[model samples]
Target: MTGRLWGLGVGPGDPELVTLKAYRILRDADVVAWFAATGRESNARRAVAVHLRPGQEELPLIYPVTTETLPAEVSYEGLLAKFYDEAAASIGALLDDGRDVAVLCEGDPLFYGSYMYLHNRLAAYYDHEVVPGVPSMLAGAAVLGTPLVSLNEMLTVLSGVLPADELYRRLVSADAVVIMKLGRNLAKVRDCVERAGLLARAWYVERATMEAQRVLPLADADAARAPYFSLVVIPSATAPGR
Candidate 1:
């Protein structure tokens, strides 16, 4: 019989946020797979480090390129396709051996998490299940003591990597906004938020729920650069009584 494949969301940088189901799976899984930048530790694995059992086989799927700009001839999509294909093949081999594999995701597996790539490749052929966890935007809002939305208000989640005009349009149209993937695009996102006339209402959060967590006004964030784990939250204007 083919072994089961588990996609476990460890949650937004906090061990406490891991669900009891995720904890149980991690403890029982024969192999723990996670993604990481080449030459770096896996942040997903780190988030659930406390619960990992001794002697569990660790599989680190090192990415070839993370934030680096691609060359003219090399496309980001092609690079990622090749990487995921190989990663899936490796994981597939383990599954064929009847070894239960649990892939750890930093946040909710379906919510912009890297596990989607693997799922796209392996889901059709494998028996798999995804365990949900708190996404970073929700965690950030919690840390800021703010509500993401109020009744009848729409919340839009946008990637900072979106083009300036698109970002500006969405920012202006949404009742509340969560801008994610704020790394090298911090200045661009900041400009869009400002152009949307929501700068003062925006808050920046980095590494939410982690020891190095920080929440500050978007205007005060160092636009020079931001880590990949950063995001900006804009509360709804029509929030209750406001």
Candidate 2:
């Protein structure tokens, strides 16, 4: 018998950011799974403490961050494929054994999310469910006091991991843009922001929804910008003297 699977996005870094539906799913989950850096912390797992139960099974998928330090030439696709294969194997084992599972996602499951990789791997073979949660962009936009997009505005969400030339083109045409994966890629992304002439309107948000959440104008931010748990949003309108 195929067991049930839940890919539940828990939002950015705050427990309060989790949706009521996500809360229900978490409380009822028979098994909890989250991505964890090989030997490091799991913020995703920590955020759900209010609803997490003792003795629930925990499946910690090895997140690539803070793990692989190889040269930049490595084919990330190949590396990620290996990780996905391994993750699928683990989830498959549990499902085959008739254990229902909840895969905790940090943000919207399908939005530049890690859960998608696992979901694509596991969902085809089992009964799966995706529980949407508050997105970081929403939480960050509220914290920064900015509406990400207005009527008919073309909004684009990009991965900072893209090549600058490619990213630049996309930014130029977009009325509002959200750049994710801004850790080590911050410099590259900042350059694109400058090239696109959108720095004046860009804002950076990090660890959104948490008490330690941070927001800053891209103009004042430095190379010391926080990486990983961060994002930059650029609105099309000029604030003042453009």
Candidate 3:
């Protein structure tokens, strides 16, 4: 019989946050795969490293480029497309050989996880399962001790890379919001939040649940120090049970 493909979410930073199901599948898989930057260690692998037993083959899918900034001749989308295609092929080869392959994702596998690209490329031809894990946005709220959404409130999730005017418009209309992907875009995102009059209500969280975790008011955050894992969260104005 052909081997099954597993997309396992290792949760946000903390190893304790990994779901029992994900751990079990990860431990039993014949091969473990994870995406990482060219030289950096894989956060997803770190989350479940202890659980991996002897004899499991490890597959490291190194990214060709880690940042959006690239040479004029290179296309980010095209490069990534080719990369994922090659990665899918590698995993497919293992499956064809009856080796169950589990792909480790940092957060929920389907929520902006690299595993989604692999799933899209190979799920049609293979038996697979996706195990959801704790997403970073929720982890951010937990660290901030803030309620994310209240009754009848809508929570909007936005990418920090959006244009200034677009970010402002969305922030203005949002009841509760989480803006992710804040690295070099921190200044722009903060500016948009301030323009939308949500800066006072917004909280900035970095590396939530990790040893380097930090939480502060968005208005007071230093844009120059923001990392890719940082995010801005605006909790609901209405308190729960009020």
Whose lDDT is greatest here?
1
Off by over 4 Å in 3: 240-242
lDDT tens per residue, model 2, 43-136: 7787786678878778888757453577888867778889888988888888888888889988788877788988888878899999887788
Task: Give the candidate order by descending TM-score.
Answer: 1, 3, 2
Instruction: State every prediction's TM-score relative to the real structure.
Output: 0.96, 0.90, 0.96
lDDT tens digits, residues 54-125, model 1? 877899899989878888999888898999999999999999999899999998999998899999999999
Off by over 4 Å in 2: 64-67, 71-76, 238-242
Clashes of 2: 2
Per candidate, the number of residue pairs that clash is 0, 2, 0
All-Cα superposition RMSD per candidate? 1.5, 2.6, 1.8
lDDT of 1: 0.91
Model 3 agreement with the true structure over 1-242: per-residue lDDT tens digits? 78999999999989899999998898899999999998888999988887889767899999998775898998999999999999999999999999999999998999989999999999999999999999999999888886889889999999998998899988899999999899888989988999988787889999999888988888899657588788988988884421
Error of 3 at 161 (Å): 0.7
Candidate 3, residue 50: the lDDT equals 76
